[model samples]
Target: MTEPAQEPPFLQDPYAPYAAMRSACPVQSKPVDSGGRPGCLVIGYAEAREALADARLSKDTAAFFDGRGSRRRLHPAVSRSMLASDPPRHTRLRKLVTRAFTTGAVAELRPFIARVTDELLERWSPGERFDFVAGLAVPLPVIVICELLGVPESDRADVRRWSAALFSAGEPDVVDSASYSMAGYMTDLITDKRLHPGDSLLDRLIAARSGDERLSEDELVSLAVLLLVAGHETTTHFLGNAVLALLQHPDALGRLRENPDEIPAALDELLRFDPPVSTATFRFSTEALTLGGVEIPAGVPVQVALGAANRDPERFPAPDLLDLDRDATSHVAFGHGIHRCVGAPLARAEGEIALRAVLHRFPGIRLAVPPERLEWRRTRLVRGLASLPVLA
Candidate 1:
């Protein structure tokens, strides 16, 4: 059977059409833009990875949002961060901060993480119910990021508020205002650090180099912004989503409670079962590329289906089942190839601690409301639950 000319672009549920698109057309067309122009959406895991890591696919959305190949350059420094750029600029930025994401760096953080979780749990009352997201999950990532960057722990709340505003999916003004405020705060922090250099990632990054090569003033400021936003948001959703998964599946929770060793594997499964990132950030084609018989022209937008790819039956049998023991290496939750998430290690550590702590704090915890009443985040780009009430 031949694939249709296009799938509806507003699709939120990606399972059905994605599976069909995999065999018939790895690349399927979808109408985009205010003018209703056409572009390709890569469905298959192998094909999607190729497009994401391919040098020809630029990660910039500035041009797509504005025609004439131009952009205002949001002052928050995120637009200039590694997540949105192509090399050699991206190479330089990623290299400068790579040490912060190493395995050693994550392992060294375990003790501090344990303490963070313990303290949050201590504050909870056993018989009462509370919003775990607000009291625990939200603060966990915020505190960890602040400590990693050597930002004052006291400033985390304000910093996190600013962080959300900067990355919000809204009009240019909302984003622009948030960026300006965050930049001002970061600039002040960097200036203070320069006068009194400390043992923090940001301080070391300021001094990072490659045999005489160093990040410029602009890159330095931008890198700080990226670390702050990414440091909190991704893990924020990860912890929230993991809790939702556990409440939905009691058997999985029992297994983890019995054998905490399964936490790592379970973290991998949570990431695969319901990845925090729903799709890759916008990728613009540098040249015409065809996939599964569909053609995507230059400068057109292409979004990889991360959630769909994670659940692709071709890759994993019983794609909907949450198997903690499954080999999750193939999932595109962190994405594929060179452009994969640089913060995966830190995020993983946070997930392990978050889930283990959830079990410890809320023994026999259950959903306060029915699953049908649960409200998920409406935003299409980032997959997250709005709330998951827990009765401790």
Candidate 2:
């Protein structure tokens, strides 16, 4: 089995390693992301797309850790979520969620979203320097998702802290604690929602769980945690990446500024250019499968490089250039097939609103430090700027 070099391939730019892998070995057994688990990396566009849609490639964590003895399971609140389950369970969880996140439901939040964006912009005055992450990207989605989940405004900070620790590349003990704490918090929240059902998404879910035999208590808790985390993390990073991309490509930024109508299309291209979730969560083969002429054994984990596939020359012309007009709808940024991001509509809306507001508020916004001085999150699952200082 081949392993990546000691120095993490994605530390600075993951594309180089991804390009090399796509060209030299599109599908090869390799060490899994950061955790040193056995797996394969699929970088080619076609192969990655096929792998994402392949049913034989299971999302069950139990299948992955079946024979690992002591390393048997993840916290149920995370492992049982729709993202990590196959057909029946995933289908059930997604169906209940679809009722709450329909297009019309998400579209109705446009006014609330705009209000949040305007409120965030009020932080920066003319010529003031502010952190794009802290002032906008991070809090915007956090507040929106928290409100939707019926989380008390006073408790949002604690939720954010718990989430950060849960998703970080930190100590194992700390990660475990965060997971336990979040699981406990979500359980209590659901119990409270049952007694006091408000007109919120969580209330709807609680009703579904109680009224019909729609889901178990565990599934209810897991789904709630999934929505809360997935709702913000991807969008948060996408905003940071999108802003940085716009700053680097002045022509594209200028085009959007001149024609606000193009903001929607520009957001699509930005997602394709620099996806927030660099690689998909994880997929394991249920049986031996052949991909790119390589045979993957049953139970081996697989990670599809969504960012690399989005930039594949075969799939997108002038893959390296940031063309706001490019038709990037087929990009696997939100993933492919049934497992694609359920909150994609919300994320897109937030992206357009956030970028549009930022540009309008500060047409002169520019990076405060040299590009090389910027720090990237060290986790392999995501690609995001830790902080984006901007002079507006």
Candidate 3:
């Protein structure tokens, strides 16, 4: 008898699986890793929050791999970026990058973001069907991040291809290839910026690399790749997920249409309802610890399920329902503690501008196909639609 292949748990209704896991234990043992080391998944809100900030749960993935004597190879830039470093190094890298994403810096981008939103929305014809993800959600952030990072307009297509491949969890070879290509490209970009400095963020980074507060060549290249990829990828998925949520809940959509001013304030709730990043990047346990009352052996990997924690009934009453009126500011959508996403301010600005423009221009926009028919990306870290078909 032929047996049916089962859909991946993440591709299905992930909430039910999350709830099932949470019910069993907030922190549960996961299947063994490729190196035969056991791991744990943290699903409870309190536990996840604690896990994110726990110094014992290290983010130094390169060190972890080296200690395990694993033969797997990763680009030095990819493995050594701020995203994977701990304390002293993480602090230095974060401080340098944080300068570009300050409050005033992000606010300065509002006019540019609005201009791009209007330009992108101009293509939608009345009563016409189009893939919203392709048309707006994907390109808007990509364009914005590219412009911010001084990536030439001509090279954005290749940049997007390389960035997308970096997240292909099911394909290690593709990820490695993308990492090498992106690192090489970033190295060249840094050299060009050094030769011909400009006002772009990359130029500032290059200046820092050359100045007293120095950055190694590897650090400079890695930071550029991280900013380029992280800056857009999360926002892209966030816009797609936010739009889908609004479309599914027409009442909320109508409310936003009637009161566009509320859109910005409502973004937190949208983020909490269906966060873009499903699980945070992997963190390794540096020592034996008790998380959510479960004993975690030293050196095991820990994954905090941000999506699950955001919807924890213990923290959020009526977790399943999307209530824009609710105060969702505390959601771990951007993650928590020292390693929180540095690009959140820019992402929120982009989302607010993009969402407002979409609703204003295409108030009549509706899904072209059933919600269930929409396929999600197979990546483990992010939650986003492959394509959001809509009639405008």
Candidate 4:
């Protein structure tokens, strides 16, 4: 008997596999979960976008697992957050927190973000070797998100640790432990907020009212955990990916350095080129449906390869090449449809400010190690450098 085909090493370099898969078929059947159960991956730009907005594809993962009689091992806080809900519930949870991340709200934060960026860069000097991922990329978002949520400065470290663990691929136990810890911590924080309210986002969330509706305790805790973890995680990786992309393309980096104002516009291309979220969160078909001419059965998980779709040749001419001038607003780096990332505004502001600050601060910065020596994180869902060693 022929041995089972070896799985593609997606964590190492998913782009090549994504290309091959998309070329074969936009929607190809594959084993998506750790259990090796068969599913499908949508790699075409059009198909992925369609699937994202397709009401037939449900984001309610917990309900899907229940239908199969398989107990979902993830914590309810994670499984029940707005990211994992559908319809009325998702609509409600999202509305409660959307005000905090509006374009105007994020714009108001530009000065504070600039100050934080300057503060983070103050530690590095010219001619010094710096691990950009650890020194700046990681800490900047952590500080910003923690402060926004009123998470005590003392708890930021643990929050980061637990958030990292929650995304640890192939470590279900660790994910469970981390999720539980995060949920517990958020619960305590919410309780504290009740006793002594402040002006932080978390405080506002606790006191938020919509007509006659109010968030339940579980909803509140779940939303808090989701915000605290996701708020920083995507921005952290986006910064690392953005920096790495600029370093690899000296010409693009030069232009950005020459005209710092263009950094904001170039952020979209950078995100499209190497998105922080390689694939969107879990989504499954609620009913049997045909997508990209492929038949998908009901309840089967479908993963939209954001990294792959962003580079689909059909959608983007010379997709592989990094062209900053290209109109890349169509990229799904922050996803598409109703479930699109709520923090896109904040993330864009953070990326723009961080990139401009870094380039201005270290005009002579260069990769300290060869591109081959750089390590990417092993998580399947997140694409980011584990450590970006550079000389300034």
Model 4: CA > 4 A from native = 1-12, 209-213
**Per-residue lDDT of model 2, residues 94-203, tens digit only:** 88887656779889988999999999899789689888998999999999999888999887888888777666774556666777788889999888888888988888
Against the true structure, candidate 3 reaches a TM-score of 0.96
- RMSD (Cα, Å) for all candidates, in order, is 5.9, 4.3, 3.0, 4.4
Which lDDT tens digits does candidate 3 get at residues 1-392?
Answer: 22224446567569888988898899988853555577899999999999999999999988887877766566888877899999888998899989788889999999999998998888878789988899999999999999999999999999989888888866878888898999999999888888888999888888773443598888889999999999998899999999999999999999999999999899999999999999998899889999999999888989999999998999999999989899999999999999999999999999999888988889898998777677687775898887888999
Clashes of each: 0, 0, 0, 1
lDDT: the better of candidates 1 and 4: 4
| TM-score, every prediction | 0.89, 0.94, 0.96, 0.96
TM-score of 1: 0.89
lDDT of 4 by residue, 223-248 (tens): 99999989999899999999988999
Candidate 3 to native Cα RMSD, angstroms: 3.0
By TM-score, the better pick of 1 and 3 is 3
Q: How accurate locally is residue 299 in candidate 2, as Cα lDDT from 0 to 100? A: 77
| Model 4: how far residue 238 lies from native, Å | 0.4
Q: Rate the local accuracy (lDDT) of all candidates.
A: 0.76, 0.83, 0.89, 0.89
Error of 3 at 213 (Å): 2.2
Error of 4 at 368 (Å): 0.5
Task: Indicate whether candidate 1 or candidate 2 has the larger lDDT.
Answer: 2
Error of 1 at 330 (Å): 1.4
lDDT of 1: 0.76
- Candidate 1, 325-347: lDDT as tens digits: 79987778888877788889999
Clashing pairs in 3: none
